[model samples]
Target: MQTVELTVRRTVGRSLVFQTKVLEVDANRDDPTIVVACPEGLDPLEHHFDASIAWTSALGRMEYAVTTRPERRGRGRVWLLTLTGPLTGVQKREYFRADVSIPVVVSWTDGPPAVSASTNGTEPQTHRLAGVVLDLSEGGVLASVSGVPPPVGTQVQSVLRIDDDEIVHAATVVRHVSLAGGTGVALAFADPSLHGDRLRQVAFEAERKRRRGD
Candidate 1:
């Protein structure tokens, strides 16, 4: 049986919108698989590929990393890649064929501009960026933000740690929408589980309250 190896690719731009890059994966002719390597500094989201994806011979994209290039140290460093598609698993074998994506600070000091949402009654903090999330794999997140839409194939670090554990990560603004009472925005995340215990706790409490009508 032939297998397909999936990897993530990404891009970093001025803004953290649809700035994802697409990589050229050598599609397997005999095996119907694509094997790509994980670039430096990036990681893959782990829980987004649990369904049957229609087999398409098209290449996909994702985010990789943000680093300070040695040569360009003065200007700082940021690198991202676009992969063929999200990694998939071979039946019940080794989970999924994924790459490495770096996780951002729920709210770092000099990190990406993050929108702080306190779980407890704590003071509001910051992360990196904020916007709608797109795709999430394992390593990091992909997001879409405000302002003019970004070009296709551009991956930006666009997530805000609203809470301590349950920070919203890897998201994208699907499109700009208008609502009767509010501004409509769309987003995506890497994986609900990767969000940590706080997010899960919130979900659990919500469910419990709903059941009790509290």
Candidate 2:
């Protein structure tokens, strides 16, 4: 009886996110379905509405997209979610890393690049560098930048364009390596702020597209 997080969103409303216990997994059927104990007082989930489920596993957080329906069993209601796609394995950090190439702009406050100016209570000068995000995850991104790369531990801001959406994140340079044309650096998000869900969705979609060779 493992606990899993469930999220359901109607086409025109906010998402419903809650924790539920896994009751059963029926994988033998044409469309595998997972049965989970419904939370008390929850409205019946919209029939065949899309849902996302996540559970922590030994490898990491695992996520799945499903079509949900309410079912009755011995007077207790349960959620029957049919698998709509392959399970996505998020890493130990609870974020799925996607291999992608997208344009990015990394900026840092001028001065000691390692120290954020907000800590000193002074108006900070800013500098920007153009880069291409080689890979992205909910927690961070690996990017290739021409010219000099920022040192490890430097705090910076990044703007990433994915499709028609633009995401901005406060990040710290975590790792770097020399490359033939430029330097590759990894920036871990310091705080995802209001864009956490957006980041996860983007990473998931990118991973799915990669798997499908799209």
lDDT of 2 at 143: 93
lDDT of 1 by residue, 122-210 (tens): 44333343344332332233334344333333333344443343354554334445544333333333443355333333333333334
Q: How far is candidate 2 from the true structure (C-alpha RMSD, Å)?
A: 10.3
- Report lDDT per candidate: 0.31, 0.76
Over 1-214, each residue of candidate 2 has an lDDT whose tens digit, in order, gives 7766677776865566665778888889988889988754467654746888986554668899988888888647888988888978677755556677889999987653355566765555777889998877667889999767778999998999878877898899999977678899899998743576666666655655554456
Best by lDDT: 2
| Cα error, candidate 1, residue 50 (Å) | 28
**TM-score per model over all chains:** 0.26, 0.56
Q: Pick the candidate with the highest TM-score.
A: 2
RMSD of each: 19.6, 10.3
